[model samples]
Target chain A: MPRFSSNHLETLLTAVDTGSFEAAARALSITPSAVSQRIRAMEALAGQVLLQRAAPIRPTTAGETVLRLARQVRLLDEEASRALDGSGAAVPSLPIAANADSLATWFLDALVEVRREADVVFDLHREDQARTAALLRDGTVLAAVTAERRPVQGCVAVPLGIDRYRAVASPAFVDRHLPGATSGRDVLARLDAVPLVDFDRDDDLQQGFLRRVVGHAPRSPRHFVPSSADFARAVELGLGWGLLPESQALEPLAAGRLVELAPGRVADVVLWWQHWNLRSTLLDAVTAAVRRVAAEHLRPSPV
Target chain B: MPRFSSNHLETLLTAVDTGSFEAAARALSITPSAVSQRIRAMEALAGQVLLQRAAPIRPTTAGETVLRLARQVRLLDEEASRALDGSGAAVPSLPIAANADSLATWFLDALVEVRREADVVFDLHREDQARTAALLRDGTVLAAVTAERRPVQGCVAVPLGIDRYRAVASPAFVDRHLPGATSGRDVLARLDAVPLVDFDRDDDLQQGFLRRVVGHAPRSPRHFVPSSADFARAVELGLGWGLLPESQALEPLAAGRLVELAPGRVADVVLWWQHWNLRSTLLDAVTAAVRRVAAEHLRPSPV
Candidate 1:
């Protein structure tokens, strides 16, 4: 086996990050030619083309393997540095991805706990819960809050809890749109004529709930309000009826500001926390904080 | 031909928006049974299932056609009301979608001009430029700023001009990452070793620029910062080099805070304004304001 040079791997990582040989040189405080020489040496040692010479440069398949290795090495180095230093001022930045609703709700509470205990800077990527695990796969984020139950390769999946949603609208809107109690069939028939609220174009929670209740998707005209807080507010203002997390809807429901459309029906979305399996203090710290918050705020997973 | 009852259509629209039969009845100031009777009558008249009997209710295919007709009728009614009112204080809320970069740049200026001239409440939806047109197709937005050149059905597309970007980094970052002069090939080769800044995982501007310069993609470690202003700031802070809009880069470039990586290389993204072709004074006023601002701020479209 060819002996891999840590210095060469570091150079490769820098080149990809800076996007050009000259930029990499600048980042490492070395001559651009030296940066080039190191990469060429590594390529010769690996006996394969690692990088595709494209603008902004991307790694070939071989390059991806090396990039992952380099990142792992860097993480280990950082852990060692912290351990040796003991002051922990040289804290590493933790990049994580989360869905918008989670970010708007209990995710911030977890972040607060993490920040209070650790001297770290957080870089957050807001994405759909279903797509967040892709960030972890691409190595964009170290951890993610996602709806996918399966763990990504080299990662561990922990069941956080379920996000329960209720269909709700303002009392005035209910009175104005649906005046009297009718059969379930009548309720379903009137759904087509009603206006509904959506989180965004990709959001199908309302439709999914509709399908579960009536065995078909609701084809009502919808007002798409992407923000969680504003979506609940839109329902309150009688703009449209929408599905709100039980946590968000509970208070409004209690105050009679909003009422559940179907008294017994609820949409429960199970959430999972996925993170690298590597044993790192920072990662462990973040995991503990997130799990603790989830226990407090989210509903327990059904058996 | 069956005579469509506008009153029944209005009832349907109210029911869909209100999310419950009772809510629609309340909105119409009638009993819930009355709301149900009107809908049943309309369904009998149409001789088709107009609504799916689902929770929150959805329109069937036939119902979608009627829903569109109802919205058009509503728009026309609003226009007529404005013509008769003359004061134009009863302005309709106009929801539009735009990418984050445009929102952070000259888009707000156009919005300000629109607000100054018209009595309009803007419900702005921030999304990626590439995906804004989907909102228009789903009837979520009346107007959008997008990279798609094709006009949505029932919508007209107007060229808004090009947004040009430059590859830039802090002078200090350049000094630190690249100490000495080197050939372009050498510069390309070293790119793999440097750190790069990304707006998000989907952001490929830097990689696109790299591909254009080096003929391959860079596989460097990257820091994903999703905000536009913060993205530019990260580059200035020596976190990494990235592509910034010429509008954003110019001031920093002039102030010696940022330097272009490839002297003559630039990325130009063409933008277009798309909106419903309906004849409304308010929509016309907004279109005019946006065009005028784009003419002043953005580069002319390439012939």
Candidate 2:
């Protein structure tokens, strides 16, 4: 077998992948003739035709093999470059793998900090806290605020804080529906006939709270408001009484846009930060920043 | 925060990553002015600085954040393109994580069959069998061949086959060194004292085999031949006797170039295919092609 230079293979693969020799040449910033020459040389070396010359040109079987390797070589190069570039005077990117609420509330500020720091890069993978560990497990993300306490394999887990939840209803709806302030089972039984706002099909917290409060499963009609913020909005708009994150509900509650339906009861979910175990300086920098931010914003856990 | 068009970000990232506006423009196959305009537009929208215009331009912290996302966006696009392209008429590029032995042997041929049958592209990750699962878990690869019997979380595992290994020496070395056929403990114990070829410092197979054959571990002074093929070549050149894969040894043995120093007793390593549990057609097609090729080339496991 004739030994072909990696650069030669790269030129040919890029040409075929991008479709036209002219386009590939443009992409590679080489002359079209150079791209052509590289392809011809590779073909002669392998003794096989590589690419089909047509619109949106395609790779032949042999070409695909080399093309695959070419892409890998490129990715490895990119990764190595990222590592090398970050090795000196590089600040860690404030990458936060958070759900909708945190992103909408505090994550943007984190992004701002990332921009202000030394050359840093952010990699955000949006996922629910219950599911963010999967991102950590896959190495798709560097840090995650997750519900799971146990660390995913090859990761470190640190307790961040808790997000408390409370049942709230629109003031108008509560006054009109309840007619009188009653914390008794008789008043609670009437809620079974009232419409309730559920976060989504997967949400059980609202129903679960109702069940525990009333000593039975919820028999109430439910409206599905999927987004965490939207679910709160739906409740404020009098769509239904529902559980809302305390951080989210505080402003509305204080403004009387929402009335606390269950003042004494609260659902507190403990959240943890899970991240890869790589001794990357960037990872440590981001971790420290995130820990500081989380401490300032979230409720402290009881010792 | 200003929303960035994925295309514009991709262009900017490629430009800085490749270095020089002209080089980046060449990489993206657009005019240098277009590259310059894109970066200017991004900086204006973000109302902040982006790239540092040094000899080879570099991303500022904000620029790096966008660049990281640009890389992710490109990868996602490639993956989506592969999925939408499908198999049968065209095989999409199949992303696989496999060990060095498989890549050097039959894996490439199987990929060729996949390309012939479908509109496929491939992203192959070369890793150790023990570490291949980490690639799959990280979502960096679609599939992998792993030595671990237990499947990585969220992945399904199927038997690929077994690779059998045996200790062998070149006829010239055996003649010069041994002079007479010997299977005694003295000969085996002196194996380490003799110069031997090893795949790497981590490779213990040769020494492990020697320890099993003799009462003590072999104490051979060793030379490291990193590549799987090169390790076999080193032994063939009489650099030292080492464990060789049966498939790799077949041609040399048939040509009378190699003789099995210790035959009958060989090591068998079972291999398994593991892939993510996703409702993806591209993954299914690659799995089928892989299974077919494995059946054809690998030794069948005993029931």
Candidate 3:
């Protein structure tokens, strides 16, 4: 096996990251010809084609293996640099993917607490919890807050806790649309009449809630608000009823701005923190901060 | 040819929109059985299966054809209701998709201006300009601000204007990394040492600019800040050089906080206002408002 040069690996990583040989060259501050040469040399040594050379270039299956290796090496180098320097100012930028709801609520607090202790810069990618793990697979992010239970390859999954949501609506909405609802059947019947708020086209929480409680999905006209903060506000504004995180609903419920429609029934979403198994101080600090904040804010996971 | 019942079409549309027969029933304020009957009747009449019976239901190829018809009828109904009502207070919700950069910049001004005169509630979907048109095609949004010059079917495309961006960096960063840059070549050569800021992994504006001017892509350490407002702030904080909208970069440039890397070269992205071609007064009003705002804020489209 030919020994891989870190410089060639660096060039290959940049080319993949930037999506083109030219873009990678610009990012590496090298000539485009130099970037191509380095990549070619690596491909020759590996005895396989690495990149597809498409617009915003893509890695072939062989390239993905090489890319993963490159990322591991880069992480170790950064770890070594931090160990040698012991300076807070030169903290590495830690890129992590998280769902919008977490970002809108408790995630920022965790980030703030982490920042207070460490000099790391955060690069956050907001995505759905169900999909965030893909960022890890693609090497776009080093860590993620995801709903996936299984760990991505080369990563460890830790249960952060459950974010419980409740079916909530404005007081006036319940009164106007759901009058004389004395029984579960009546409430289920009245659900058809009330407009529902959805997080977006892909949001299924409300439907899932309806399915579990009423034994059927209620098809109500929906107002889709894509933003996490705005979606809660829409429900509060009486645009529609929706599943609001308990952390978000509690204040409005207490303030009389919102009321729970189905009081005991909650939509519990279990979240996990998935990070590279590599031992890096920044990753460790972030994981610790997330766990600490989640313990205080999120409900304990169901046994 | 058999005539389609607007009622049956409505049921079909709701089923697809809500992703289930039960959810559609709730929106229409009818029983789930009634929804099923209407859908079955439509399918029998058309001799085709309209929906794939799955969780969070998906429309079949034939169902998509029917779904489009249902949307057209709904839009016409809304237009008719507004025409007959002539009441500003009961204006319908207008959901539109736009790129994040525009949302962080001048898009809000247009929204505010439109809101001042109309009682319409805005449901904004933040997406990339390259992808916003997908929302229109799938009937998730009625309108979009997109980079695509072509009009979506049943939609009219209007030239909004050009949003020009400039390559910029913090003064301190330039001083530290790019000292004694007499020519574009020197700046290009120094780019490898300087960090770069990216909006996301998909953002290629910086790389595109470098390829055009410097003739190669540089592979430098990058900090990806996905939010437009935050991305600009990252550049201002001396994190990295990036392409910033002229509207955002001008103030910083004047204040000596940021400096232009390439003095004359600029990336001009032409934006379009695409909306459904319907006889809706509200859509017309919004189109007029967006065009008015674009005229004032953006450069006239290239002749």
Q: How many residue pairs clash in all the candidates, one count each?
A: 76, 16, 25
> Which digits, one per residue and each the tens of the lDDT, describe model 1 over residues B12-117?
8777756678878876889999988888887888798877768777777766656656655665666677678864324455668877667667776676576555
| lDDT of every predicted structure (CA atoms) | 0.74, 0.66, 0.77
Sort by lDDT, best first: what order? 3, 1, 2
- List, residue by residue over B140-228, the lDDT tens digit for candidate 3: 67888888789998888998889999989987778756888977667866775566788777677887876676565555666676767
Q: Over the stretch A1-303, how does candidate 2's per-residue lDDT look in tens digits? A: 466787886687567545689978976778999898989888888899878887777777677556645544443454456678754322222234776455444444444343334344343444666667655553335567777789886678888787788878888668755678677454565775566777544456777788877887666655554444445655776656887777778999999899887677878877777876655555666677767777777789652
**Candidates sorted by DockQ, best first:** 3, 1, 2
Considering summed lDDT, which 10 consecutive residues are worst modelled in model 2 chain B?
B86-95
lDDT of 1 at B36: 87
lDDT of 3 by residue, A58-152 (tens): 88877777877777677667667777887532446777988877866777667656655654566789788666777788676788888887999
Q: After TM-score superposition, what is the CA distance of residue A231 in candidate 1 from its true location, in Å?
A: 3.6
Which regions of candidate 2 deviate over 4 angstroms? A1-303, B1-92, B184-187, B215-217
Docking class of 3: incorrect
- For candidate 2, write residues B10-51 as lDDT tens digits: 777567646789977765778999999989999998887888
